[model samples]
Target: MGYLALFAVGVTKFLLGKNKNEQIAMDWRKNAVQVFRQEFDHVGCNSDAQSLALMQRSYSEYEYFASGRQNVFYAEANLSLRKRHCLFTTLLFDLTSQTEDLVQFNIPLNLPKNMPLEFLVCRRKDLKGRVSKLTNPGNFIKNPNSKHFKLSEAEASSKNSLMVLAEHDEISNNLIDQEVGLVLAKYGSLINLIHVTDLKQYNNFPLFLRAELQLTSESEEAQYTLLGLMLRLADNVAAYRMSQTVVQKCEKSRKQQKQEEQMQVKQAQ
Candidate 1:
């Protein structure tokens, strides 16, 4: 009788803990969406779906909130670009060996078809761990050493805390100029990585400028600033044109990727 009673108590405690954790996650999601909505409104973005309230689980331990196709008609750029993003808030317990849960915000902007470059910039400390976590069609590089050129001196500061890489030198030079570097340096600690690439597994956009931010606080002001920076990055990317040589290279790479994907499907059958 005592053993059965102890088992019942254990089960009750587990249930209570699970409920408590879920409540905390819900609260955080609420606050995050509120802040995000404010930024989207300021930028004249219409949340077509407002899908943050919908929860999805890719695996038992991972859960995320996705915003579906926030359309922004930029009269300034004369382009209609779409914003799609996901927030991965606090992993479930025992999902990883880490002691603390971290919140990640991933924002990707759909790019025009003419852009033919891939770019990645992040703090040196985050490079290895961040690359390891990126899975599947989301993965950026076949081999980091050969595929990516490390632009260690790009930021031009003794205290440079960034590790920059791009498929083309032109992309690294054009995108990471003084203004962009200042925004990145200001919020360097909060940023995990920002990259532009055409290799997303689910290729809706020919390319995308994606930023992954690690939210450490509930300050809407800071979040707004970071969000604004992302907008600036997208605008700058839209304005820049790739050289013909690089464009040809990117087109070749895309063709090869399609061929490999077709081969994999055939093998599966």
Candidate 2:
């Protein structure tokens, strides 16, 4: 349903084009469509990215707000962090439906209300099927209350989504980081896109993606913890894009193969 709305915006934009300019500009169209038609689609980004960039720029300029949406989120410090870049994701909406005079759409990201340190991770290789130096599945427990409890290898392997005991440093590969009452990080919810959300504003991508990070101290730099998260989001995006490419290739191959088979049958007849 959402994708259909975005597609409609793209079609509308193609009919009514925007003037290419130096200032920040956003439109309802797929800004890359022209380049796509010319086979140089990698040229620019869409309106969604532009809006996000503007929001980021606003934070860079004013840099302060007592409360409301502009409040200083600790993760915003990551914007100046080393070896990292700002990453934002948003929901795409059509502007056409909202106004008759306006020809653009609005894109807003579902920013986290608090700094959550949890994100989801799929099992790369089942421990039961393979042998390695990694910790045994049975030796770890996910809940802080059950720190000493051990999960059986049989029980762990059978489950698809294992609740990662994230807040505790003892058990790593945590999918959710919960300390006290606040959630720090979390993986994707039940949806199509993979999500990495936090409780505080993620001005840049989170850092904890490389390693399982459970904050031991309240003073720890939240910006750095999110770095690993940002990297992991990149991995997820890359994997999703690769799957799309593979699917396109398979579709083309199937079409060609079908045509060839039809030709052969006609010739035999």
Candidate 3:
């Protein structure tokens, strides 16, 4: 009788929690769609909620939010989210405290001119944690090499918790100018990483910019500020040009990377 009563209480609590989560998801979807449609001329979104198991009833699971616009600095932009999915699995993996819900933005660009190099600037704290645990749709750096720069040194001196990884020092130095520094200094806590690259196998664009941010705030102003920062970054990347010699070096590195990829494929076959 006692076990049956406890089971009844557990199931009731689960159902109530599920209903609450569904309502919140619906509200979030509505607000997000309205926000993007206001910014874009032709905006589209996917508000479909992911199917969850009985153990996952307490969490929001995965929800996808996408939007796009033409005649802008970027051709299209979209957001994807992954949150607490399964309670038992999460506990088993020891990801209870570590799982800070991920909110990532992918903006594909159609630049009239090409950037000769690719670069990444990210929060140093996420190097071995939240950002690293994510999958391809959000992951930019498959291999963190010598290019992480001396961000460790910068982190020591400054209040900023950011890191830069670039094809060359010239690209990183030029891209992270005064304007960017000011933005980072002010709102550095909200951002995870910003990557400008043509190398993502999932994206077809010649060049694209991706940012992972923690949009936990429900305030409209905070959301707008985050979105605005992303736009500024896209514009900056679109407008940058390196010296001819630096461009040649970047192109050479790209070729070597391609040849290595091809060789790896041949070896696997």
TM-score of each: 0.54, 0.19, 0.67
Q: Looking at candidate 3, what is the lDDT of residue 170?
A: 63
Q: Pick the candidate with the highest TM-score.
A: 3
Clashes of 2: 26
Residue 263 in candidate 1, Cα distance off native in Å = 8.9
Off by over 4 Å in 2: 1-10, 13-160, 163-269
- lDDT of each structure? 0.51, 0.28, 0.56
Q: Per-residue CA lDDT of candidate 3, range 1-269, in tens? A: 99898678666656665565555455444455454555554344323322111112235543433344442443233333232333344445535454444456677765677765577766655555634432222323332343322334546455447665666666665666666666666666777778777666447677777777765545555455666666666666666777898778777766776787789899999
Q: How close is candidate 2 to the true structure, as a TM-score?
A: 0.19
lDDT of 1: 0.51
Model 1 off-target regions past 4 Å? 1-108, 129-160, 218-220, 252-269
Ranking by lDDT: 3, 1, 2
Root-mean-square deviation (CA) per prediction: 9.1, 20.2, 7.0
Q: Per-residue error at 91 for model 2, in Å?
A: 20
14 in model 1: Cα distance from truth in Å? Answer: 8.7
